[model samples]
Target chain A: MASPMSITALASDTIINAGAVDYLILAVYFVFVLGIGVMASRGVSDSVDFFLSGRSLPAWVTGLAFISANLGAVEIMGMSANGAEYGLPSVHYFWIGAIPAMLFLGVVMMPFYYGSKVRSVPEFMKRRFGTGAHLVNAISFAVAQLLIAGINLYLLGSIVHALLGWPLWVALIVAAAIVLSYITLGGLKAAIYNEVLQFFVIVAALTPLTIIGLRKVGGWGGLTDKITSAAVKNGTSAGDQLNSWPGNDISGFSSDLLSVVGIVFGLGFVLSFGYWTTNFVEVQRAMASDSIASGRKTPVIGAFPKMFIPFITIVPGMIAAVSVSEIIEVKAGGSVPGGSSGKGVAYNDALLYLMRDVLPNGLLGLAIAGLLAAFMAGMAANISAFNTVVSYDLVQEYLVKDRDDSFYLLVGRIATVAATVIAIFTASLAGNFSNIMDYLQTLFGFFNAPLFATFILGMFWKRMTATAGWVGLVAGTGSAILVWALTSFGNPWTLPGQGSAFLAASVAFVVDILLSIVVSLMTAPKTSAELNGLVYSETPREDLVDANEASHPWYQRTIPLAGIALVIVVILNILF
Target chain B: MSVNTTQKQHTAGILDIRNVIGALLGIYGVILTLMGLFGDTETDKTDGINANLWAGLIMLAVGIFFVAWVRVKPVVVPEDLDTGGDDPAYMEKH
Candidate 1:
């Protein structure tokens, strides 16, 4: 084990010699990503192609891109930080939270969206609810997208600053500029292609790191002993509190059996269902699939690979905790330093400390690159999505109408630039917050969660009125803000319970849904023809031909394969 | 429009089962790996290795079940009314 200061010094020394090589590798990576964008631009002859990759992407490509987009820099840092702080409990985000949600969205919600043939989630909102609902959805989504972009930039800057002694703004600007250049030139195509490259680079780097880290700490037995010893000294045990099962501590289940049930049924189901079904970022990926069947399977296919992320991302943190515990104990007189009440090491800093001390030089460079890939993938996705929605949903809808293909393409480029600048500025302004990942999630939850609720209701319930969508959108968002403000008062709102603010916003959303239904019943029901148009577009006769073709039996074959995955998950849970 | 509704219904049912099984197998792989990495040796390293054994057995069974199910289940034609394109095969004959 090494002291924090000593570890930092070692990391700095190793990185200094490799600075030129690091920069060269990164430059080449940047140019490669940019080249993909340039090639992708060639396909951008129409608004549809620019926004949706000409809707010809294969199922696997869409699935891969979808997962890659969600795999942002913040997620990597956040997951690593979580692994460091909570041991295995961080797996909840992927397993109990993200995977099931993705599957549900693909199977249930995708059919509706693809069947309707809408370009953007907001456009679908207009059809399902009305103009006012569309406006609200667009505004809220834009805010969330901007915040996500800013957070990614901020994290990228922080990591560079921590590792290389570079100024935060300098790192932020460089990352943003590189990502923005590709996104501006190529739109979703560039983002997808670059994301694919990033996905490979990140996996290649992190997989070996996890293995080496475990070996460094002398295998599983040695790792456990170290952690158990550390935990006993710290007055705790590594159990469900550390592991992310259904009854995990972070799910707010503390000795009350009823609370655990409520968390599983209410929070777990609702949050996962809401995100998978309604999130624009996730939905955008599904929308890019070549066909409805492919769209449905894309998420399911994506989930197979995604299930293993905790191994690569979370395990390293646990290894780090075991390795670093001895140093922290010595430094703080048997107490961990910088954690909540000196119980553990600071979660975000834990992995970095481990990397600095444990990893050799060349391996260290690879790890850094892996982390950078995570950041780039995340940032690039945000910038691309932000530019697309702004250009297609807002600019095309409100500012300009009846535009030519080239005109729309130009608008996309301008939106990309504007979005990049805004994100960079916001990143610079956000001062150092404890656990940068949590700060970003909190900001996103404030804006996006309520919007997600509204979209879910709008899509599923036919009785949901435009008036209800507006009321819910405004009231839900407003309540979240008010709660956030009130919680911040008297103190800086650092308390863990402050996250309950999302609950208030969620309540407002439910109320809005109920009100909308009552209002719609009292008022006139939309005509059947109008409702049909809103829900289902004319199924192109050509699609019927392909649907009838027998060329691709593999698509049909994957159905049962997906079933095997589910049974295996349940059996594992019972057995493990 | 003349496609067998009953067959489509059966296909949907099989698809649902397939999806569940696939998710289970995928999740099982993850859990098995985690347990192997994080299992407490002191409690059940030698005497009560049933937990580890059960995990492995369950994973194998579920995986086998999924493979067997996929092998046995009849393939149904995908309803592809969404792959709209200029591809000649997809073109409607007048």
Candidate 2:
């Protein structure tokens, strides 16, 4: 008879041999990361250095760190899980949603933000809109950050606990403490350096695991044959049915034609334009670069490598799907496993299951480390970002009217520790939710999608008023909540799928914009000088070669490349 | 001072064009690659035959366009840093 703790220990040992060796390695890595944070703190003589690394991070560091910041535990686990469940279609999220947004940020929005020389995104909002709108956006964003931080922490805790037989709360506290120590000491600079390290570790771990897994299944040829056979056994054809295009019958989860179109045109545009353009977390990285050129070019440079992530994350899952048939047939008399049952294997758990069953000894530790790196990288960035927002936007803006550099730095560190604790608590509680990805998307949609639309309208449209900004924000969020509620009640509100919620939110934004326009037109126009000043305040004159000029070449190159890439992707998609 | 201002404006315009072109190309390339790799066929298979061919052609066209744009709008070298006489860090070494 297996005792409870012994069973847990046995399960963990089976996965990673989490004896003294694994613990020692993880401990050393944690110490090294904390040491870097302490080293980075030497330059923190003032608030500017503490908050933004004195805006002196190089292009490569910014680029690598920015990519790493986005590459968190949620993505690592989520993508692998999605790969197990959805096949190749999950790749679309990266290709369609993330890459374009990064490109847009590098070219179009970076100049405006970096040029304005604003320390925070909310500061820019206050300048563009007004006090009320700025406060609302800032508060909403801080809350969103808390949620993201919680999710990342929860995933990290679960993975660590599963692999090491540690208590879940102990794992959560350890992860949070490790992340908070660095973020509390060095702010964004420490986070970026840590992220770069994490990125390399993560890729190194995942790459070989993928190769060996493929080899175990008799290489790509054998894997393809197995997938085809399994598809037939599951009563689906080998072709379009397997592809996750719109109008497919593989349940709502499939990335069929309608969902694809919606994601590509609607969710893709909104996510890229909104999240990258206006979101403080993303922009904060850009703002901390050594120069405007570094700020803009880093994201562009980052996109080249980021394009390959799906290959790393999604391909392995597709490979796993081929073997799942055998596992399922033997265990449950069907082509799916009972462990996952109807609700589907918890997304990240699928990746863990693969690592435990397939890999040898040392390699398993590396993969686990990679996942930990992803979680740490994400947690550091989010905590750093949250601290910056709370300290700069909320605390300093509302409470402290005048403060010395030392005061602000001290406050920033305190805020970071507070934010990490909240995130850890939230992560422990969030495990009860069934589908983490859907939950994250729905929550993100309610706030971010509409926020993106309003920002675009505000920046480009000279007539957009503060009242309109407020109304649009409320209406978009309200409509998304309503739609989410209706769908939960089994309404089956399918224009294209669950993604319709995003579309509905966007429509609400448009309606708000029109109403804002009507209201603004009835009122007098603000002077041209005021409008021009807002637009061109940070914009450098044409003649001088400002730091912003250095990034121009990369941005210029990426635009046409993106277009050509899109055309090729579409053509290949159509033919092959 | 007046001459310096005129030079700065010209450089800014040239840089702006370069940034815009780079961004567009970057976005185009990523989207095309994704569509090629995971593009849905009429039959719902992973047949990326058409997507591969098209992506190649599109890349060639865009590559040519970027080359031409760079040739036509070369960046003008500036005489001094444009730091508005603020940060000494921006001042060029003599």
Clash count for each candidate, listed in order shown: 25, 64
How large a fraction of the reference contact set does each model reproduce?
A: 0.00, 0.00
My TM-score estimates for the predictions, one after another, are: 0.76, 0.77
Q: Compared with the true structure, what per-residue lDDT tens digits does model 1 show for residues A491-518? A: 6543243234334445545655566666
DockQ of each: 0.03, 0.03
Model 2 spans with C-alpha error above 4 angstroms: A1-14, A19-21, A240-244, A247-257, A324-347, A432-441, A490-497, A532-576, B1-94
lDDT of 1: 0.60
lDDT of 2 by residue, B1-94 (tens): 0133344433333222233333333333344344445543212111223332244245436545755655665444233323222121211111
A395-423 per-residue lDDT for model 2 (tens digits): 88899968876788888888888889898
| Model 1 regions lying over 4 Å from their true place | A1-24, A246-248, A256-259, A325-345, A432-443, A480-509, A533-562, B1-94
Best by lDDT: 2
